[model samples]
Target: MLLQLDIFNILIQGGKGLKPLAYRMRPQKIEDIVGQQHLVGPGKIIDRMVKARLLSSMILYGPPGTGKTSIASAIAGSTKYAFRTLNAATDSKKDLEIVAEEAKMSGTVVLMLDEIHRLTKPKQDFLLPHLEKGSIILIGATTENPYISINPAIRSRTQIYEVKPLTEEDIKQAIDRALADTENGLGKMNIELSSEAMTHLTQATHGDLRSTLNALELAAKSTAPDTKDGKVHIDLAIVEECLQKKALVQDKDGDAHYDVISAFQKSIRGSDTDAALHYLARLLEAGDLISVNRRLLTIAYEDVGLANPAAAARTVSAVTAAEKIGLPEARIPLANAVIELSISPKSNSAISAIDAAIADVRQGNYGDVPDTLKDAHYKGAEKLGHGTDYKFPHDFPHDWVKQTYLPAKIKERQYYHAKENGRIEQAFKKQYDLLRQAQRK
Candidate 1:
């Protein structure tokens, strides 16, 4: 009991009266690092590189909170070389040159540059020559696609390692560790995490460890004073208030923008109106105009095709209205369009049928156009009888001719198969069946 009290006191005082809780939780060795065992696992590429002291210039590309910075720090810690850090967002070309001169004078240097994609072309070029000479080993971290954002020359020299987002298991383990750690964590508080709270935090964070930790920290602090019998029960209501409502919502320009939009599309596809509306509200709150417009356009065809052909037309009209009206007034039409398309019945194979037919023709399944449909306007057309077998549909009953329109090679091919659900497609099916039946007789 006394030992536990001392541990709690030490944690409350912030780790030997020096390091804070966040710093105390920082991994000291590579093995202590969580979530990225694939890269730093025993005998893996990174482990082999570190063991052999053959660390190459490399880029760590992944979404935020997947341990890119931590891995780079671990590499530097494990190495005998001097370590230096800089942010490309604030550091200039001169700053890089200064580091280069120091590296030349002081022997090997490992320069870990955060947000390397933010560096200008010249700044990136400044590091190229030094990198080639082995005076400095570059470790760059970026959230963007490196091929499009990084300098091509710099990219060619450096090896790229992609870090994946942490799994739900990873996030759960991290939270548990934070709660149990005596130093720099809520060691003294017996905080109970409700299942709903845990699930909500995991989903809301979108695989960001930093955000998750911050959220847990906030939740604990907020619930600390409300404890009873040395146990604080954190319910869904507490989590929703402390984390969800004030969590900065997901910004369209921010890191989780793509994730939120993907969730929105999936919700509509799954026919979950509640989930779809939640994402819609997030996007609308963020003021993401182009993304909203683009998604509405896709939803029109992908989710509302043929069922209500007017949905696509309405979506296009909404886009035009958005352009002319521009927000406040435009938001109304956009919201209406999104709701209309989301709730509307859906069909997809209408477009897929045409695509399949084209593929068949390209593969030589259909060799040529029918003789009746061939051009007869040329000078020598009379001798070849291009239009000789043609029968005008107007001359037949119901303005339709009982004839084969397909080429000889693919005369029996049937590409389109209409769905029986939508009203629009039913009409097409009736007319098509009648025409084919008459042609057969």
Candidate 2:
């Protein structure tokens, strides 16, 4: 209990402006929120609730610096509700009682609970009655998925919303706002952020606005003032220093981006596990998740097809899991996918078969459908000779009755040539060879 109060008090330190620049710049209204337009955009859930005067408990889950706490703060400010901050991991039951007493006196209080995934049963028990009676609105913030990490009792009471990571543009807007806001920002310092520095600040942090803002502050404060212009200049070097990451030019539009992506896929195709992982790490460091996910999925069906069918299927599943969780933890599922794909026997036979079929079609080589294979359900179809001489294989032993099925012009056409590259595909080839022999009759 004593430990809990100590940890909680440490976070609740000092007057406004004394805290971090990120804390000072928290949105005071839904309009002031920098990102998370899905939640606070026009006609969105949080915006709609604010506009409609329908306040409810909600759990905001996402990667950090994506405006979970800012949303809670904005809701309180806009609704004119008394706001209090607590740590579910550190704050105790007594802390909940304090918020409840305040809520009772003030009609309603907005309790922004950080790390709500760590809420103890005692603290939850103390908060439940107030939450039920509408005296306290709980805005639980967590990086973990609420469904998996939070207790069901609390989970059942709150609307769970996933906060997406901010885009480069969104982070740029926030940095611009911080640069220009005279009251709560560094506007008075005459700090000039170079365009190169701005790009690094926005893109290199992987959309972490808190890290971007603080790093901007550090760069501005640490650099000596320019004597000629009387302005503090923050350049790319200083930003790289503060961020502790080299600004690798990994923009989606650049040639380097495509180069990295090509190397990543080719490495896996060549069955170089370590090399593939190295490229994956580079892409991840550049925060190129979309491309990583996209390329991996494409490789599954295109490169790793019949050789290891289950591995291909699992690549899709791994990518889905990675997207749901987001990064740096997203790396885990992505890594699993990368390792499996790199070492798995590789093949492009599926794509090869499709390409062959497509080429023939493009050349206008697809002949008319055989009469026996044509649609025969309509009343006049059989009279048109469409269903004539068709053999229903289901009635025969082994379901092996065979007949001429392909069109006359392309009766000998064979597009899918099964490979014997791995155990699975070898088994597939064995069945395929058997079917081919039977079809020749």
Clash number for every model? 1, 0
lDDT of 1 by residue, 223-299 (tens): 54442476667766666665554323433233465788888888876767778778877876544555677887887
Cα shift from native, residue 72, model 2 (Å): 0.4
Model 1 TM-score, all chains together: 0.58
> Quick one: best TM-score, which candidate?
2
lDDT of 2 by residue, 36-142 (tens): 98889999999999988689999999888889999999999998889999999988888888888888788999999999999988888888888888899999999
Q: Give the best candidate by lDDT.
A: 2
| Each prediction's TM-score versus the true structure | 0.58, 0.72
What number of backbone clashes does candidate 2 have, counting pairs of residues 3 or more apart or in separate chains?
A: 0
Please give the lDDT score for candidate 1: 0.75
lDDT for 143 in candidate 1 is 87
